[model samples]
Target: MRIAFASGKGGTGKTTVAVNLAVSAVRVGLGTAYVDCDVEEPNGHIYLEPEKDLSLPVAVEVPEIDESLCTVCGECGRICEFNAIAVLGDRVMVFPELCHGCGGCFLVCPVDAMKRSGRLVGRVETGVSKIAPCGEDRTAPGGEGEISFVQGILKVKEAMPLPVIREVKKHIPDRDIVIIDCPPGNSCPMVESVRGADRVILVTEPTPFGLNDLEIALKTVREMDIPVDIIMNRCDPDAELPAGAFDDGGARVIARIPESREIAEINSRGGLASLESPEFARIIDKILEKILRAAREARR
Candidate 1:
């Protein structure tokens, strides 16, 4: 099962929920992997601390123009919908950033002036890391069994996170389970992260901002034809979950975590949030149970 933990916006404890759930899965001896798809600001490494096993650069192919070729034909420019290649006067300028690496310009060029070259964007790192002990499983070995971890670190000032995100996901093993820590928001990055998951866990708070964005997030997931459930973070006692939050979205709340200062303090100290709070641990267990059940049903 590829479970993706995502949210409507940032700072709703998305990573906190993802890392904890993945750790819990590892404790149960499930062959698990965690992919931090939040390329722009991947933070799961801060928790998993996986030993670096391999690192590789990820790039996209863009058209490289050979000025020596005779014809400055406008064919390449017309075929490129991205406008990556522009023919002006007698010069053909290729914009690497705007290129989608489709290599259309190269294919359209009759004189073979256009060629494909790698435009380095980001790097993908894969490693192995053990989940920290949660105390619930006293017999569970610590640092004895490790789960695979992979993350994509977007190059600074790069705009294309989707390519890097796709490369990182390619590392997901064909196995029992994998948790994806997705980037926040209902935008393209979030969409790319949660695109093909067995289930998407939408983490949100109870505040008005949280509720509003939750609706948007649900819509995004629903459009992708994926089933999603909520993991309410900082479940405020005074604030009620919006009644119509899931109105037509087909999403429901699967777990709720009330505000806890202890969790906050532990997180601040770089400690695991879910393991430290058994209350939260129970909630995550429920989440895991739900995911496990869904996977079983899918197999049948």
Candidate 2:
């Protein structure tokens, strides 16, 4: 089963839920593989320090001008949909960052001077986490004992995330449950990560901002025709739309993690919050059960 955890906005604890859920799934011997689709800022590896067995360089095709071809009719620049190419007098400059690799510029180049060049976009690292030498469980929250797998990381300042996200998702095992830690946003990256997912767990807090973004994310998921479940992280009884509200909406309230200093302390220490907090772990387990139930029903 491929499940993706995403939020409409950042800092809403999507990663926290995703990482924990993967660990929980692995704990039950599901052979879960967690893919950090948040390529822009992949923090999942920080929690589960998997060894780097294979590192494949990811590149994107960008327009490269061959100045020797001469005729700078400026047609390439004019035809570029992304404005990635610019022609100044007799000089043609290619701004790779602006290029979307559509190949339109090269196709439109009258002189056939524009060609495709590979520019480094990011890389995918595959490996498994070796049990710590001390015999302690090193896997993050959801990883109860120890598990190993592959992880992808997008180079900083890389604007394109969908390609890398797709590449990483391709590595997911057929029988293994895959949990994608999506980038925090309702943009292309998040969309790509959530696409074709069996279920999406939208994690959020109880604040007004969290509620607002959650609604937006819910709308997005509905539009995509993807089943969604809500998990209210840091839920406070005093906050609006208490636990029952989420359940009332058709989407189950699988987990309600109360706000606590322990969460902060563990996060500060770069440790999995669910691993240190039994309450948090239980909440994650409930979400996992709901996910499995939904999966089984769909199969039937």
Write candidate 1's Cα lDDT for 175-257 as tens digits: 57889999988888899889889889889997778778888988888889888888888876444466654665477777778
- TM values, all candidates: 0.91, 0.85
lDDT of each: 0.83, 0.76
Summed backbone clashes in each candidate are 0, 4
lDDT computed for candidate 2: 0.76
lDDT for each residue of candidate 2 in 1-300, tens digit (9 for 90 to 100)? 888898787887887787777767776666677778888888877777777678888878888888899488888888887878778987989899987777787777778887779988888877765332212443344433444565667788888877678888777666458887888888788888899899998888878788778877888888899889877778774444545335446566566778888887887667776667887778787888889999999899
lDDT for model 1, on a 0 to 1 scale? 0.83
